[model samples]
Target: MPVKATREQRVGWHAAHKAACGCRDIPASLRPDVIKLLRSRRKP
Candidate 1:
């Protein structure tokens, strides 16, 4: 067996990515549109 990272590491990466993308001021009103755009551009 080996030492391993838990879900927090993965979750943290996404949080960091969002921060880097400057989503800090995303308004509640635009969340749905943002989500839709992200969903439309789903990863491979």
Candidate 2:
């Protein structure tokens, strides 16, 4: 991640990292946004 990454960028990188590595979880600070993103993807 960059020194000044935006929230969306951080979230995206974390999501991808989780899928590709599975070595760590998303940080607590970004959980809500991660949930929101997951929910939105499930919608039509």
Candidate 3:
């Protein structure tokens, strides 16, 4: 089985993802849909 990620790893991943996407603060209009899309694609 795969190991679970630690809190620090999660935080680092979010930071890196935001930096790479250049969307640290997604706008209000797109926030909901964007988050939904992201969650839908999240790997288990």
Candidate 3 per-residue C-alpha lDDT over 2-37 given as tens digits, one digit per residue, 9 for 90 to 100: 169664454445544654785567556555655665
Evaluate residue 37 in candidate 1 and report its C-alpha lDDT on the 0 to 100 scale: 58
Q: What would you estimate as the lDDT of candidate 1?
A: 0.51
Model 3 scores a C-alpha lDDT of 0.57
**TM-score (C-alpha, index-matched) for candidate 2:** 0.66
For each of the candidates, give the backbone clash count.
0, 0, 0
What is candidate 1's lDDT per residue for 1-44, written digit by digit as tens? 12474544434444445546964654465555555555665678
Model 2 ranges off by over 4 Å: 35-44
Steric clash count of candidate 3: 0
Off by over 4 Å in 1: 1-20
**Model 2, 1-44: lDDT tens per residue?**
89999999988777767656869878999978876776665647
Q: Give Cα-based local distance difference scores for all models.
A: 0.51, 0.78, 0.57
The true-structure Cα RMSD of candidate 3 reads 12.0
Q: Highest lDDT, which number?
A: 2
Could you tell me the C-alpha RMSD of candidate 1 in Å? Answer: 11.9
Candidate 1 clash figure, as a count: 0
Which is superior by lDDT, 1 or 3? Answer: 3
